[model samples]
Target chain A: QKEVEQDPGPLSVPEGAIVSLNCTYSNSAFQYFMWYRQYSRKGPELLMYTYSSGNKEDGRFTAQVDKSSKYISLFIRDSQPSDSATYLCATGSNAGNNRKLIWGLGTSLAVNP
Target chain B: GAGVSQSPRYKVAKRGQDVALRCDPISGHVSLFWYQQALGQGPEFLTYFQNEAQLDKSGLPSDRFFAERPEGSVSTLKIQRTQQEDSAVYLCASSFRRGAPYNEQFFGPGTRLTVL
Candidate 1:
């Protein structure tokens, strides 16, 4: 099984719709969960970050992590066309003395007007 | 102010060629990272550099892959004798972390490499 699994979505939604993107991981060693948004041909940008199991909210975006189920989510409230991008979920663990990052295949999202 | 800048935003090379991708990180960032993003997939970790030293490179795929951040400000990832499988977008990121405050990596506009 992949260390991190996210649906390869080409999810289409109307503007102002609430968007929920999720990911599941098999590695319990994973501690930090993060969400990144990538526009076409651009590199992934940091969107939300959370540690362990809890929820963190920033403006219109909310990130949730469930360590017990090894699940993580990024919720976009009142989404916009600008939110039409790939949403990638990634994790990191301190294996040795530094960081070991693991990533999932991103979910491609398109919010139309 | 520049966020992060990568040189030669697009590169095309024949198989067995060598290519160098460059990254100029944000000033004063302590940690740098390299990742490979194949089509339709998220970025995969390639290596990490902290200051002038490369602390962990276990994620690097093979001997053909190498990265260096000699001055601790700019980093370059070099791929030697590249194969067709090496065609992917290479991304660079830098962060400020002492022992791990927050791994909120700031990424550059990647260098897309295509090998034919």
Candidate 2:
């Protein structure tokens, strides 16, 4: 099984709608979860990061992790046209040689005005 | 402060030719990383460096791939005898500190390499 899995969504949503992006992992050792936003032709920019489980909120974005279920999510409230981009979920562990993050195939989001 | 930057935002090379990609990391970041992102895929780890000391390069796909961060700042990834399968975006990232929890790597605008 792939270490991390995410839906490669070209999801289209209207403005002001709520957008949820998610990923699941098989590794139980993953202790850090993060979300990244990438626009066309640009490198990914870190949007949110969380350690362990629970929720971390910054402005209109919220990141949630459930270690028990091995699931992670990024919620975008009041989505705007500016929110149109690809969303990637990543996980990391401090164990062994896991200094690098395991990434999922990003989901493409298009928020129409 | 400036973000990480990469040179030759785009590169095209013939199969069997060698290509060198450059990365200028954010100043003073002790940890540097290289990743490969194919079309429609998330970036995959290729190598990691702590200053001039390379800590992990197991992520490199083959012996043809090599990387170095000389002087503990600027880095270069060289693909010898590039193949068509090597076509992908080569991304470079750097973090402020060492270890995992602090590995919030700041990425550069990757160099898109196309091997024809």
Candidate 3:
């Protein structure tokens, strides 16, 4: 099984809708979870970052992690057309010197007007 | 301040050809990383460099893939005898510090390599 799994969604939603993107991992050693947004033909930019479990909120976006279940989520409030992009989830462990992240296939999102 | 920048924004190579992709990281960043992203997929780790030292390269798919950061600044990823499956976007990222929890990597626009 892949260490991290995310639905590669072409999820379409209207403007102002609340959007929830999620990912699940099989590795319990993962300690850091991150969410990134990528536009077409562009590299991904970090959107939210969280360590361990619990929740971190940044303006209209909130990131939540459940270490027990190995689940992570990013929620966007009042989504806009500009928010249309691919959302990728990544997990990292503190083990050893290899800090390489395990990433999931991104979910493509389109927020229409 | 400029973010990470990668040269040869786009490249096309025939199968079995070699290609070099360059990354100019943000000045003063201590850590550098290389990732490969295939179509409709998330970026996969290729290698990591702390300054001029290569710390991890387990992600390199084969011996044909190589990366180096000399002088602790600019880095290059060279693919020798590329295959059609090698077509992907190569991304570079840099962070101000070493390791996670303290380092937040800023990514470059990436180089799109098309192997035909």
Candidate 4:
């Protein structure tokens, strides 16, 4: 199984709708969970970051991590057309001395007006 | 202020050709990273550099792939005898902090390489 698995979705939603994106991982050593947004032809930008097994809120976006289940989620409340982009989940662990991150395939989202 | 800049935004080369990609990181950033992003997939780590030192390069797919940050500010990823499978978007990122506990990385637009 892949270390990280995310549904490569082209999820379409209306503006102001609540959008939920999730990812699952098989590694237990992953301690930091992060969310990134990437526009077409642009590099990924960090959106939300969390290090615990609870929910973290930042304005209209919330990120949740469940270490017990090896699951992570990003929730967009009252989405906007600008939110139409690819969402990627990234995890990092201190395996030995390396600190590179493991990334998911990313979920493509489109919020229409 | 510039975030991160990568040269040769798009490149096309025939198989067995050698190509060099360049990255100019944000000034004074302590860490630099290289990642390969395949179509429809997220970026995968290729190598990491701390200043002029290469701490870890185990993620490099093969010996033909080499990266160097000689002055610790600009980096170059050189692929020798490139294969069709080497075609992908190469991304460069830089962070202000080290140790990688939770420093946010600033990424460049990336260089897309197509091998024929």
By lDDT, who's the top model here? 4
DockQ in order? 0.73, 0.74, 0.73, 0.76
lDDT of 1 by residue, A1-113 (tens): 88999999889999999999999999888879999999999988989998868999999999999999999999999999999999999998766666756899999999999
TM-score of 2: 0.98
Report clash pairs, candidate 3: none
Lowest lDDT 10-residue stretch of candidate 1 chain A: A92-101
- Candidate 3, B16-43: lDDT as tens digits: 9999999999999988999999998889
Give the alpha carbon lDDT tens digit for every residue of A2-67 in model 2.
899999989999999999999999998888888999998888889999996899999999999999
Q: After superposition, how far is residue A23 of candidate 4 from its true place, in Å?
A: 0.5
lDDT of 3 by residue, A25-53 (tens): 99887878999999998878998899868
Off by over 4 Å in 3: B99-103
What TM-score would each prediction reach against the true structure? 0.97, 0.98, 0.98, 0.97
Model 4 residue pairs with clashes: none
Q: Is the docking of candidate 2 incorrect, acceptable, medium or high quality?
A: medium
Q: What is the interface RMSD of each candidate, in Å?
A: 1.3, 1.2, 1.4, 1.3
Number of the top candidate by DockQ?
4
Residue A103's lDDT within candidate 1 is 91
Where does candidate 4 stray beyond 4 Å? none
